[model samples]
Target: MLAVHFDKPGGPENLYLKEVPKPSPREGEVLLKVAASALNRADLLQRQGQYDAPPGASSILGLEASGYVAELGPGCQGHWKPGDSAMALLPGGGQAQYVTVPEGLLMPIPVGLTLTQAAAIPEAWLTAFQLLHFSGNVQAGDSVLIHAGSSGVGTAAIQLTRMAGAIPLVTAGSQHKLQMAEKLGAAAGFNYKEDDFSEATLKFTRGAGVNLILDCIGGSYWEKNVNCLALDGHWVLYGLMGGATISGPLLWKLLFKRGSLITTLLRPRDKKYKQMLVKAFTEQVLPHFSTEDPQRLLPVLDRVYPITEIQEAHVYMETNRNVGKIVLNLSQ
Candidate 1:
């Protein structure tokens, strides 16, 4: 099996395909023959030695994959069999041709979706779902602000927010990205580079502020986030793209608004918690992706690259030029 490997923690140029032993299924797990996988910001961080894989997780780089069931481990329920098409939410190791996954974390590929498309679903969609429903406790009539609105998780968040009957406001750096977000159900879009998104958000809500915020850019946006958070609003922090150092009265301002600052990371969570989330997401959201639905959910894709071009894929993601998920076609 060939997997993406890095000799040292550094840039995308360090990434290369190396022959590695294929992983086998463990108890209650399934061996998947991966067809496609997706790239994420975490992958870039891990490559740069900024983030480490959780204890007992694969050291390899992908967090999600779409594949066919190859084998099932003992103690696994009879939910899947060899050759079943499935996509998995992984802690790591989806970049290779073969990887093992806990049976409970596997989801059936939505009807009418290709393997490359399904590959984009697990991590981004699940993260957005968890952020909006679980962490943010979003409610109908609520106004939610999603940063990086055209990003994989951000795009998913916009749609999910609308589904919950909440208004979704987004901030993107470019006009094209803002347009993409609007098409995906964002009620309003803000250009963070040209305008203060907090003020734009407040203006969009008629000076009432947003009821919830999905913040991926931490530190730099801390003050802005609080400024536009409604009273008792929830602010879910899942990433720190803009740096992590805070030098001011962050606590005082949040306290003033009675805001709740909740931080979460799906990759490092316990398996039981992931299983529960997967089950809930499968029941509540997976069906909408099927073609049978008139307004089916969409898994936005920006680019697809062959697994052999892992370095180029990473470079592309680093450019911050993508509007949606960047997929790696492992089958190629």
Candidate 2:
């Protein structure tokens, strides 16, 4: 099997394709012939040596993949059979011709979606669903703000929030991205690079502020995010793209508003926890994709690159120019 490997943790230049032993399924697992894999910010961090794969997991760069089940190991017989189309959220090792995954992590490809589109769903959609419903506790008619609105998770969050009957507001760096967010069901969007998003959000919600906020930029947007929330609002932090330290006085405002600040990460969680999330998303969200209306829960893909152009893909992602997921077609 050919897999993406790095000589050292540094730059995309270090990534190379090499022949490696194909992985075999263990108990409760299945071996998949990977058709496509998607890119994420975590992949960039891992390549730069800022993040490490969880203990006992593969060191490969990918976090999610879509493919066909080639074999099922012991204890996994009834769950899925060989030749079944599936997608999975993996801890790592998705950037290869094949990967072994826990059967519980595999999701049947939604009806009418191609393998490449399925490949783009797991990580972004699952993360968005978990953050909005579980952590943020978003309810119908609630006002929610999503930062980085044109990103993979952002695009998913916009659609999910709207579907849940919440008012979805967003922030992006460009007018084009803002438009894209609105088209995906965001009530409104702000150009974060050129506008005071906090003020804009307040105006959009008529000064009541939003009930929840999904944030990826950390310190730089911390104070603003706190100010943009309604009383008893929830602010969920999933990334620290703009540094991690907060330097201003924010405790008083939070106390006055009875706000809650929560931080979370998905990659390092135990298998049991991930299985719980997968089950919840599979039951609640997957059905939307399988319905007769195939467009209902489609993933937004920015671009698809062949496996051989892995370096170029990384370069494109690092530029922060994409409005949605960037996929790698393994079979290409």
TM-scores of the candidates are: 0.99, 0.98
Clashes of each: 0, 0
Please estimate how well model 2 matches the true structure, expressed as its whole-model Cα lDDT. Answer: 0.93
* Tens digit of per-residue lDDT, candidate 1, span 1-332: 99999989999889999999988788999999999999999999999999999999999999999999999999999999999999999999999999999999999999999999999999999999999998999999999999999999999999899899999999999999999999999989999999999888888888999999999999999999999999999999999998899989999999999999999999999999999999999999999999998878999999999998898999899889899999999896
- Give Cα distance to truth, residue 197, candidate 1, Å: 0.7
lDDT of 2 at 20: 94
Model 1, runs deviating above 4 Å? none
Candidate 1 residue 47 C-alpha distance from true site, Å: 0.5
Local distance difference test values of all predictions, in order: 0.95, 0.93
lDDT of 2 by residue, 155-205 (tens): 999999988999999999999999999999999999988999999999998
- Where model 2 places Cα greater than 4 Å from the true spot, the runs are none
